[model samples]
Target: MTTNTLDADLALRLAVEDLYADYVHTIDDDRLEEWPGLFTEDGIYRVTTRENHDNGLPLAMVYCDGRGMMADRISALRTANIYEPHVYCHVLSAVRILGASGGVIRARSNFSVLRTMQEGDTSLFAVGRTFDTLVEEGGRLRFRERLAVLDSRRVDTLLVIPV
Candidate 1:
């Protein structure tokens, strides 16, 4: 249950990367329910465009505080939502673990979301950096807070799946 300084650092970095990868894959797979499992029970997940969160609009394109709210999001997507059917592919790089504070680990990485539709239309939907906090929970590393600050705010409606 003990990690040396070097091992802790490496593991923490790898864990965050794995989480980020799984994040992209899960959305691509349309596994909305399992997506929330990547977060801690008490985690916070927010999706906001730079214009909004920066201008103090006090609104997020999407915001879920706690696993329950995330779960609600998935539910809405599955049963109560309708939108253009598309596929998503996320490309990430430049991941840097800033440091740790108390029980929280801070990290940032670049992300690009590419989408394709059934009719063969493809485009870059969003590009951004994932700002996250991580911690050990349920015997695993999980996100305690995740903010997807997008570079593209032209959300084409129905961000049912977490970006």
Candidate 2:
């Protein structure tokens, strides 16, 4: 590749990585309101089991079809949902950029979340692989779609938070 081409590729990779970092930090820091900003205005987010995904089932544990819906979810979590107080620590592997086309970048990453309760007990909450479609909007990378496929079908507690 030409020097300019190589530099562009590296820049794109770094941008995508930065997006991932920002996403996890937003959730981990209890800045849930900001989570919707990580996506495009009409972005889609879904959480489902690997079994469901592999079986081509349309069911999702959590589904938000747009930024508006995502924002509403956060609002409901803050005001309406009742569950034990807890925090999440997300560990993400390197993003594997599958390809880019029509200004969209397709990528995947493996993730594990640790949940800590108010009483200071911690446990593994979930493990998953995220398949994402990203695009640059107003000079920043944002998720056009984020599909989190959990490795297991069972969740130990209420899953109000985004994974």
For all predicted structures, in order, the TM-scores are: 0.89, 0.98
How well is each residue in 51-163 modelled by candidate 1, as lDDT tens digits? Answer: 87678776887889899999998898778888877888888889888888786789888988888887999888889878888887777778899998987667876676688
Please give the RMSD to the true structure for each candidate, in Å: 2.7, 0.7
Give the 10-residue window scoring lowest on summed lDDT in candidate 1.
152-161
lDDT of 2 by residue, 1-163 (tens): 9999999899999999999999999999999999999999999999999999999999999999999999999999999999999999999996899999889999999999999999999999999999999999999999999999999999996899999
lDDT of 2: 0.96
Q: Score candidate 1 by TM-score against the native.
A: 0.89
Q: Candidate 1 local accuracy as lDDT?
A: 0.84
Model 2, which residues run further than 4 Å from truth? Answer: none
